[model samples]
Target: MYDINTKRLIKTFTDMAKISSPSWGENAMRGYIVNAVKKLGVTARQFRSGESYNLLLTVRGDTKRKPVLFSAHMDTVTPCDNVKPVVSQTKITSDGTTILGSDDKAAIAMFLEGLRYNKEIRMPHGPIEILISCAEEVGLRGIKEFDTSVLKARHAFVFDSDGPVGKIVLQAPYHSTMSIAVTGRAAHAGMEPEKGINAINVLSEIITLLPASRIDHETTVNVGTISGGRATNIVAEKAVCVLEARSIDYRKLRKQEVLIRSIAKETSARFKARCAISRTLEYSGFTIHPDAVISQIAATAMARIGIRHQFEVSGGGSDTNILNAAGISAVNLSAGMQRVHTTKEYVMIRDLIKGTKLVLSIIDIMR
Candidate 1:
């Protein structure tokens, strides 16, 4: 029997680590969660989308009161297979070659195990919904595919950030991709160099003129990659530059985009070249007021567990961004993970217990 009042943290975490789940390949992991959650006598089911699927488990309570949702992604980044995790002293990490995939799995184990404890003790609380999303590490595709019609929650807690458990991310940047394609005529460098219109040269001018790195207080831009050139002996006929821009403020983002486009236009005019620019929104940003109901609830919950709560802004995007866009007020919660997405990633045992205590504290206070 699973112990609710007792700490089953190690058991849950061990089970989660043994499971293999990478990006689109999460069927096996999703199935495992479904079966594990079913043991709690709660309704747990999977919703299929192409090859991957999302799992939803619901724990009924007295009144709906707009169920509170707990969310975590099921997928991990690549090089996560055959992870040989070891716990030396008080931290857990992998053995050099692969990632431990604790990113969201740790959150998963903590949340589900928390629920099992609450059940065993007959904890009084409102309805709680669990959403284990798939393919979140690659893109927000799994979250994007989720059907809001099936959701009854008005507030969500996305356990996906890396840091202390008491920390909450209420703001994240809007991300966009900007591409510029330059077309020109190719000519032999030694013979007809003067006859060729150099697209690479035009792209260079645009890059130099554009305001990259940091823009003002909240916006940032970077040129991630550049390509398209045949040989050094030839004046390149075509070239392409790919860049990205991010901002917490929509206006600032728009201004940055305009600045980038203006640079491209000016470069084309000065060099007498043809160019095309394109913009695509990777994800929209979200900011919640300090006094927002969800934020207040979480703060109160954390405080009850003796951990000071801090509401802060984040530069990275997560499933919380997508859920917030879907009208579900969601906040990103930190799990005290250090050096994440690296070979040295580790989580302190004390921090893990504190995080679990925070989750349990939230449930106890919810009633």
Candidate 2:
């Protein structure tokens, strides 16, 4: 077992998890982190975006080596207000009404513990920057809108993936979000239903043609939300659907995107209605070799801590995508969080402590 202060990490996690820090409303959580850093005798700065604030803590004077950034988001999903963290002997969870907030808070706690340990040990290390961001759970808006120009870290480690302790995210996929609108002429359903075209039917045909589940090994499509038809007695005038497709291979992604666009236009023309389709490149995908600097650093850290180092692909998106897009080589590491974004969310205390030890080990290695 790795040497780490389990009590301190869990206490700090409990304190933060109990706070109400949903998506864009992270005022309380931000204050807690800022104050906690100050109490630890470290100064932190804030970067503002809309109603949320991102906290940045720098440790430069201690080490004269290259810089590395450790990032974790402070926000959680909905039903997180008034969280009650239940700490069992082996696990930590919520009271079943709200999320336990371990998705990112586990990272926050582990980072804090590692910082505290480093301070106590006075270990010689490289420049380290701690980034506690906001509004990540919603759509990765915090890191997306962030100004990385102020950061000098060449490598970043994101503590936001959900898995066991020793897993490293080797690659993430590129995502294309599509918003489509299907329009059809509206007429009274009882009187002239035959004269009107149904927008819902047009959209349904397009969806069938488009990929929904697993398209390939590295690609997947999902229809998150759709709305159409105001009343049963009337033909639908307009319908809208929000869908997204992600793929590790750019060629495959483009092909599927083209197919989706084709489906939209063809179905719209067949129904004699207008089809409006727009796609946004949400974030670029990245594939990091295991021998890369960041990956090597983490693998060495894991080996030093006597943990198995396994690199895997991530289907979900995180702040790692934003950092990589900003030209910083990075990988998302698991924080030992399980069943995130639900009332059933829980994390093993053993895994949490192991995760903390892993961060501490990475920091120690740079020293």
Candidate 3:
């Protein structure tokens, strides 16, 4: 069993929480992480990706052992400016007005502390790579744009899930995003109401024909945004709706996609309006069985740290999905984050220490 410096871990986490790292604006956070790792005598490479940079740190270890990668995002959701972490004896939270930014920061702090401990004791381990991504909250944009060819590790462990430290995400859904536009003739509402076709009405009818929210235990759909209208006194000539669908099963996801497109086409035609829809596959779904090597390593690491490991399926996507798509087997481990992406987000101090120990344990097992 490895010993974790609890005080140092807490300080590191709180310091990161104070940095404002909203999506596409993670320069400050990246700099801070680079400096922190440098203090441990480890140099990190910053790759320019989109509006931000992706930081990668490689540590040489036993060459005979397989290389392993660890990942976390540097960006946080909105309302993260001027974040003030309220650290108590039990947990760390925000000032009730802004998010605590622990969604992925907790994992970062854990990684840093684990490195410090490993260096101090010169623990036996294999080659380790840490990838800190930017703009992950926006849509996994940073990782999606990242050049995976530079990585030498084929197995990765992502620490970005929200739950206790022992929970392991075994499955994530395939995601597809859609943008639908309805076009119709416009006319004055009072002067020639019958001469116009309201695009808003046609779009509303199409939405009613679609399934939303929870489609089943493994699938979900949500209409996130809608806009279009010139004036209240005029019939709307154009309207647009943006939404997404996700499912663990690819066939089910395609079925939902086809159904949505068909309904939008049929409904718009019935209203004599033109419907244009664009759909993009954001990321493919992934599943890692319990018997897989990556899963076994995670399980063994948790067992070594006395953490009761549990398998879970997430409705959301993370860097893990993208890594798996790149042919690198990966699993997302819970970072003890609670109520993430909100002002109520918090993480337990105990879980933070446990998470750090888990990281160290995995590295030791890789030797």
Candidate 4:
């Protein structure tokens, strides 16, 4: 069993929390992490990207088993710049002004601390690869830019989800974006109202006809926002709504899209409006068997760390979805961050320490 440095981990965690790293603005954070890893005498490299660079670090191990990969994103959500973290006696959080960004910075610190501890103690572990991705807060573009061929291991663990340390997410739903355009006649609202057709009315009718909220056992639809209006006096000539549909089952997702299209067409025909509906598959879903080797390894690792565990399914998607699609059986690990993507985001210090312990245990499990 390897012992992690509590004080060093806390100091690193606090230092990382202070950095303002939002999506597409991860350059500073990446540079800092790269330098930190280099100072530790590890091989660190940066992957070229449009906005932010992906930091990749490798730690060689004995020839006992295949390499194991650990992944976490480097970017936070909006309002992340100029963060002012407020730490109480038990936990660390941000002021009311911005988010705490525990969504991934906590994971990054834990990974780095784990590497430091492993190197210091000379833990007998397999080859380890640490991938710090960027722009994950914005539609997983960072993972999308990753080169799958560079991966030497088929088993990976992604530290990104919120909750207790033992929560393991093995499945996530596939997502798609739906854009509906409603066209109608433009006329004065007060005068010639009869001659004018309201696109808003068409939009409302379509929304009312579609199956929203919970679509089925594993499907959902949400009309996020709508726009397109000029003046109160004139009828709206055009309106558009950005909607999203998600499902764990591909066939079911396509069925849901068909239903949305049907509603659009029916409402448009009824209101004498021209409707154009377009949908793009944002990302595919992934399901890993609980009995697979990857799950077994993670379960063993968590158990070794004295943490109870269970497999879970997530409705949201992440880079794990992309990695699984790329043939690596990736599972999302919980890191104890709460209220993510909000100003109230926080992570218990105890849980963060336990998360670091879990990472070290995982290394031993893979050994």
Clashes of each: 2, 0, 0, 1
lDDT of 1: 0.83
User: Per-residue lDDT of 190-242 in model 4, one digit per residue for the tens?
Assistant: 87999988998889888878878898878899999999879899899899998
lDDT of 1 by residue, 73-123 (tens): 988886777877777667778786777777888888778778877877887
- Which of 1 and 3 is the better model by lDDT? 3
Instruction: Order the candidate numbers by lDDT, best to worst.
Output: 3, 2, 4, 1
Q: What is the C-alpha RMSD of each candidate to the true structure, in Å?
A: 2.1, 1.7, 1.4, 1.6
What's the distance in Å from true for residue 340, model 3?
1.2
How well does candidate 1 score on lDDT at residue 203? 89
Compared with the true structure, all predictions reach lDDT values of 0.83, 0.88, 0.94, 0.87
Q: Which stretches of candidate 3 lie over 4 Å from their true place?
A: none
Model 3, 33: alpha-carbon shift in Å? 1.6
Residue pairs of candidate 4 with colliding backbone atoms = 189-233
Question: Residue 173 CA error for candidate 3 (Å)?
Answer: 0.8
The alpha-carbon deviation from the true structure for residue 90 of candidate 1, after best TM-score superposition, in angstroms, is: 1.9
Best model per lDDT: 3
Instruction: Give model 2's clash tally.
Output: 0
Q: What local lDDT does model 4 show for residue 366?
A: 82
Using alpha carbons, what is the TM-score of model 2?
0.95
The TM-score leader among the candidates is 3
Off by over 4 Å in 4: none
